[model samples]
Target chain A: MCDSCGCNITPGNRHLVAEGEPGHQAIDVLQHLLSANDHAAAHNREHFDRHGVLAYNLMSSPGAGKTALLEATLQALAGEFRIAVIEGDLETENDAERIRRHGVPAIQISTGSACHLDAHMVHHALHDLDLDAIDLLFIENVGNLVCPASFDLGQHRNLTLLSVPEGDDKPAKYPVMFRAADAVVFTKTDLLPVFDDFSIERATRYLRELASAAPVLNASVRSAQGLAAWLDWLRDDMRALRARIAGGEAVRPAVQPDGAALHAAESAA
Target chain B: MHELSVCQALVEQVVRVAREHGAGSVARVTIGVGALSGTEPALLRQAYPIACAGTPAEGSTLEINERPIRVRCALCGAETDARANRLLCGACGDWHTQLLSGDELLLEQVELAKLAEAI
Candidate 1:
């Protein structure tokens, strides 16, 4: 009997029987499975560039205060920056509704069973907004530390967030997310006094060990700590992006691994 | 798991390739999965059969090749393996190394069975 389906043939006959056939052939594909998604991401990048928008992909574990940080960012910088959001979630338009309450245009992408938002989903969300009218676009990916890190949504920057209550060991456990981040935000700082296990030093140490160039900052919507630095980072990035856009270049961060420690490491060397 | 989605795409690609080649059925599909590709091979293997169900590629064997992460040391000019969640250079213990491999998700090859000769 065949091993595969117990047919009236020799066991494990598929490979042998197929090879013996007259017209059987093997073809080399050598294709990346995500090539289609990458193509869509390239298109999304072009769209953002043409409209002079600085797009950011925000990733984090669930309940890491991604929405809260965005709310704070919009509240603080809305006067100077025309901001919009593409909120991704498994369900509920709650995030979109929250952003809309702040008078910012927002689009909600409900992935149903999908864990991460692919570039195609972002591309579809783009149609709901006037791209030229917005200066910055934030794609808040579904709250997943693992799956979201592997997918790129054509954002100019990839931001990863970790709340203090979630502990400082997240960087070590989810290194892929930290490695891909352009910036890391430590959120819910107001609870740090209660959560003793969370240490900025340990988190920074992990980042250093990974040789990451992403800058890390702590913020709390309650205390407004580090909000200025967060806003300044955005402002600097927006300026750099606009300059690149005007020069017909892709809006990449001017410096790789942009952070205080990276600069210190370079100087020490 | 995300493996289900990946397998779905894999089946789609296999079917498309089979159609392009005018083959009646797929005999085998070989995939190269990287260690750091964020995919669990075990889960993927389990999901493949389900993804192939109701498709022309059903019952096709999925042969997976595990690709190890390779990092090139900037200081020692040595290429070595990168352990899980660790990105340091295997040689010279330098943190400033470049990743050379282990993030790929490729559909390397496909074996197609010809239509059975008219009997």
Candidate 2:
């Protein structure tokens, strides 16, 4: 019996010590808690690449018109390219059902008590879709500005929408979310006339203050011109992604560095 | 809050590490939470107990090492601290700065509880 801490060391245990102070073993485990999610996200990304699909993660606060934008997009590019959706929400299948009504395959991920969708949830959603038939997939994330930005959903591009009603100060307040955006959209611009408090200039300046060069585009569900600009951006982005993929490269959205920044030794670089 | 979920992941990771080291229990779990991590440390501390309940890490202490937001300038190559909202190079005041750190949620270390004696 080992007299120090008493029990049976037996001289063979891996925690064996010849003659030293009995203490807790502190292991240097420099790992990210989000590694599992990042791995699952990488798997999903590879799956998307295999099927030549370009995925976009649409993020915003509640009532930011993510689904409305998708509906308009579906209407605009119905026959041109095959499209699908993965709608994530705390509850209800309303968004998925809405997308389904457009004759497109839409999968719903009901996270229940969870605030945001993780890669595993999106992985399950991908199982239901025919990726080969889809050229573009939009993962409309749960309506929260904070949590979703920290999670990666295996998308080629991350698009965050800030409605005019949400005010221009959002970018300054939610820096993490704004910084994760590859592109930001000013949604519900048609309401800007009534919501005179919202300023495009101020909002843009706030976004630029974060040192983010993410292109801000104007979009309103009511106007054709607004939708046209968004559709053009989408088409151009898809073309860029396709070109990259053709050149044996894949587009990587600027994921929140909480996990990726650690695993890839991005800090060391 | 999402910190609860993040804590869940943290517990999962700690338990896994504990098992890897043949640890029956854990005494402490240390992590680095960055200013720009989008996770609130207070919320994580609140969620820790719930996440550690019934796990090997139950009753363990969660030591949070808060990392400050830092950016490196392309012009001057100086790494300095910056505010969460403002990511400009603190030294050169350059807007063309890249994030050097501060978004990390790293599980830095873990202290395993009384090993062979406890067993």
Q: Identify the leading candidate in terms of DockQ.
A: 2
Model 1's alpha-carbon lDDT is 0.80
Clashes per candidate (backbone, < 3 Å): 1, 0
lDDT string, candidate 2, B23-95, tens digits? 8888878788897889999999999999999999999988788887888888899988888888887877767
Among the numbered candidates, top lDDT falls to 2
Report every candidate's CA lDDT. 0.80, 0.86
Would you estimate the TM-scores of all the predictions?
0.87, 0.91
DockQ score for candidate 2: 0.49
iRMS (Å) per candidate: 5.8, 5.1
TM-score of the A chain in candidate 1?
Answer: 0.83
